[model samples]
Target chain A: MAKREYSYYPGCSSQKGASSSNMMKSVATMCEELDVQLNEIPDWNCCSASIGYGSGGELPRLVMSARNIALSEEHNPDQDIVATCAACWLSTREAAERFEDDENMFKEANEALAEAGMKLTNKTPIRHMAEVLIEDIGYEEIGKGVKKPLEGVKIAGYVGCQTNRPFGIDGESYENPMYLDGLVDALGGDSIPTYEKKVQCCGGALAFSEPEKSQEMIKGIIEAAYDNDADMIATPCPLCQANVEIYQDQINAKYGTKFDMPVVYYSQLISVAYGRNANDAALNGQIIKARKLEEIAAK
Target chain B: MSTNTAMVEKYRNNFLKEVEANVEEGEWVKMCMQCGVCAGSCPLGNAWEHPPQEIFMMIRAGKREDVLTSDSMWMCTSCYNCIVRCPRELPITHIMHGLAHYAKRLGIQPKGNPTQWFSEVFWNNMMKKGRVNELKLGLSMYFKDGFVSGIKESLKNAKLGMNMQKTKRMAPMEFFGGHGVKNPGDLQKIIKKAQELEAARIEEHGK
Candidate 1:
């Protein structure tokens, strides 16, 4: 039996063939090594992400998360709901918080849920995968599994936007979240302490809509990592991973600079350090390959 | 009177009150003391015609049409920098979204706003299947401007797309109606009912 189990909510980006499916693969591999089992909530729909606020409105947005929560409660009763996606976790957690604080909103949400023959009792706790990794599976335990430590790999942990602000991981500063750095250290990699742009926004869903502005923002993040002499950037959010990694070509084209920064999930680092092969860690999925991590994993 | 005009008359031209009643965390807008912290904190502060601080003041000053029609609110990426640094504990991010949402509902949001267009496309894509078909969403965004520009965008991204396909990160098969929920119809009914309930609530507020 696994030491801990969670009802997982893999957001749209983590779906097979989606943008950050590599993130899903690495998280699964990491979880397996850590003895954590993540069971997907059956028939779970989209959490509407943050962009949904424009079209979803207040009640509909709440109801979207409510439906997912209701489903998670029914299928995986008594287990806490966990999401790897920062936006999904934030939306669902915010909904849970709203259901607790506002009676009328809760009643309205239940009414909407009634339309689908589901009801939200708001019994289960919503959590990010990082919280489980840090709080539940502590650094010492995780360190124990590191058969091939990421030696000499200087990582700048980029806790961008959603995961670092408003409702960040417990006991972590919004401006400078140290949990990612700690994870890097646990994997025997050098964590750059002066990574100033860690919490900066990667333009979120607006990256595609407004590429220039978003790329300018992405430039600042990549430059900060380079300034610190980092090997790669690790992040907790899939959108952050996608935005920071996939746009280097455009950024280089527009700005007349060479930037080939490897932005990856922290879970990938963990899996690689745990002696998992490159395929197991899904390193090939990277738009900007982390050659150093891949070399380490191959060994 | 048009609903927008009637809304103005109903609130007696008090945009802040109208916002508080209709917007999602709009009551918190009154809490802004014009410290300009939010304006300074915004990542895209220079890009906005009116940052959060100015937008808040506009609401207080009853610049209803200007506040509603301005494209500033749509620039928000919900990075939550303002919310975290806000001394008043105001939910500035939600309020910004609420303002955009309110403007869109009143049918007065700025035209040709890319964010607004993408938001609509995303919402519709997710609503149809209860899961977002990312391929369709990406194609829709590229083609939104026109056929010629869409071709340019597709060709530009062709290498990236091929790389993604090679890595198995993106499946071309997804273009033909990818994964969906067990009961997309039921999910649609839930959203429809929720929307109706939201409409009724807004109507109650209007009264």
Candidate 2:
């Protein structure tokens, strides 16, 4: 079989965080075995997520993400730039859309990029890892690769707001999104239907800008997951993971619910189900401890 | 017509003007028909003196001070529900934020009791660590806001939190301490940058 190689952009969160970084490494290793090469983009910059755009305007953040996309395009003209971070994926996708739709903005942004020795073009498609894994690479292929199936372990897939919101992307929908569910099924687990708040914000910048309100919002999601009997929660965004995991205790306190639901990067869960080392997947000491997960997986 | 126009003109203020100037994209406020969809959809609307629709109406009528000083300005959850649902596509939530900033300048107190307290603790944590320490901030907020019940409940979850911390899944409280700063100088720079951004925005809007 021919190797499927993609230019990967790990973004800032993956570079600093443990679960995201570890999972990306595992995904890369898995991809290599599956004849898929994930080449990391060189000298990538920040995606300038919610904070960057919310503090300033979209132009600055868009241009920054555009510069990174432009770099990826220069390296590979045909293959999509696969982004692991949901925020990075959203920003890069929005930037590409804007570059193609808004001529004046594109021209000005490209001019700004020229000073930094970058060019902006609307050619390269931004694919979230979830999409690339499920859509381009078949689930049966992944099922064949799974050394250990996560049988009897129930996972609540939290898609986060950015990955599937504001709709209109090809093969992506706000309602009835199936990419994550398919991935979970391939790894030998049951993916439960998430609550209405599944697509809600993980209270990203709001965590700093408005703590109490953010806490309430985070509590709402965790409570919903607990109410649904999910053993663990998986998401693609590192900031979402950080916010949701860090605040799990506070949510438990506020709602008086004992939710020991471990928040893992979806890739990490995939790694675990594939019989990769659970610790290697960085599953222990998760914000919501996964001791229960370890126990369940053992049985 | 003359009487009604005069009455409308009497309520004019800078809050609406500032909102108009700060809105970068999407439908402007002129499209608001007072449908009350924003207010109705708001999770915190009942708690506010003026719901989101009322705020939009007040702003449209140029009642800037009324909108800015209204306790409802602080009641916004910033959920972006109004922004997401507005038929006019007005950035209603963001306008509320801009009004909050303006309200601070006007020396108006936030309507809800917890708004100022939460804001201070949150920003202080951010200024000190360049990130939020949820435990420290939560405790500070518990005392400052008198949410003792919340704190007592938090203690039970503290055991779970500690376990997470041990695994390094959660950030340690000490992470907020070092933050790569030897002195308060770094903190000062962050505050200065914020002040500069606010000043630049004010200048652009002539507020």
Candidate 3:
């Protein structure tokens, strides 16, 4: 194997005070354990997440992602760009696809790149980290790498909206993405097999603007996890993890339900399983403390 | 002929024409068959004043006022649930977002749409620094309604803020700095170029 390497785009969410930095840290540890070299894409700008879509027009948003793609091609042309943030993955993939579909948009994006002395073919394969694990690091390899199996923890694999639609992992169903469940099983943990809200949207940044409505969506997702007997919820998207994890108390207060499921990045669980310490996986940032995780990892 | 022409003018087909031109994949909005799957699949579908399916209907009926004024455009989290489920493969998410930007540009956004305010605040933060400074963005958004609202919002989220701080993901010094990406000059240059290109395209299309 030509030692797996990737141009990582941690996205803006990975910055300080943001919930997704834990995810970024968790992914860094998981990558090390999996023998993956994550080379951060130098000067990678925002993927111009949905808020970008909501506020700006197509060309600006496309150019924002294009700059990152162009930078990746300039520096790491051979390696595919892997994004831990689902919105980043979706935004970059959508931009690449849009460029392919519209020559005019491509020309405009390139015009923006040219200002920075760069241009892109939109050829860089933008992939999610989860895709790297599921497709490249097979479940058996993942199982073999696990030092602690996380035997009793029951996780509801929440895929959220961006990863599995219009452009999901190759051949995965839009409505029901099974990659996360398989990942949980590989970790030797119990998965909520019939997790109904697996593909539900976590209201993304709406948790900022339309807090009530976003809370309703969050309520449904968390309640579903609890209803299915999940010890915690695991996800690939930082927005999903953050929204579900940080908002539980508010959701409980509003909905009159007692929900305490710890929402975590899948990488956190994998890192723990692979014998890394809590700090490496950035467990400190997790709002809902997972005593189960702490106990298991301590073993 | 006079009466019929007057009726056509009132229900301006130009409304649909304008949206189609403004939206990226707006032409596809014409393909919506009222399947209602979009409305059914949306996570915040209940919140939409007129859900995705009806927005399409409103577009066709030339109900320009209703379509632009609806909170549905502002409420789209871009979940893509509707796009994947649309029988015609309509990019419902994009259309909703397009309408939102269009609504803002036209100065017709619904009065009470906090989403509109928040997105603009978030967007402006990115535009200024070339990346989002979470604290700055939050401060801007909270203060957007006014100073009092800003304090209230901060107090409300104080616990969450404290938790983030304790984890060391965000530090007190971040209020002074430590959030933006390096080399903001380069980021701004790219943005300027993109805007110029976009402006030229609009001029070419004579829109």
Question: Which candidate achieves the best DockQ against the true structure?
Answer: 1
Tens-digit lDDT string for candidate 3 (B140-187): 767777889889988888887787777765666756765565777777
Please give the range of 10 consecutive residues that has the lowest summed lDDT in model 1 chain B: B1-10
For residues A74-172, could you state the per-residue lDDT of candidate 1 as single tens digits? 999999999999999999999999889999999999998898789889989999999998999888888999999999999999999888778999999
Model 2 ranges off by over 4 Å = A17-26, A29-34, A168-176, A194-196, A292-299, B1-22, B26-59, B64-165, B168-207
Top of the candidates by lDDT: 1
TM-score of each: 0.99, 0.70, 0.94
Candidate 1 docking category? high
Rank the models by lDDT, top first: 1, 3, 2
Whole-model alpha-carbon lDDT for candidate 2: 0.62
Better of 2 and 3 by DockQ: 3
**Residue-level error in angstroms, candidate 2, position A125:** 1.4
Model 2, range B1-207, lDDT digits (tens) per residue?
332233234424544555665434323666777888888766556667888777777777767557656767566544455665777777676566555655555345454545644555554554453333445654565455357776774674577556545755345544455222233343334234434444454454442
Q: Chain A: TM-score in each candidate?
A: 0.99, 0.89, 0.96
Candidate 2 TM-score, true structure as reference: 0.70
Please report the TM-score between candidate 3 and the true structure.
0.94
Tens-digit lDDT string for candidate 3 (A88-206): 89989999999999998898888788887878877888898878998988889999998999898999999988877768887689888888999999999998868999998888888
Q: Give residue B23's error in model 1 in angstroms.
A: 0.6
Supply DockQ values for each candidate. Answer: 0.85, 0.12, 0.61
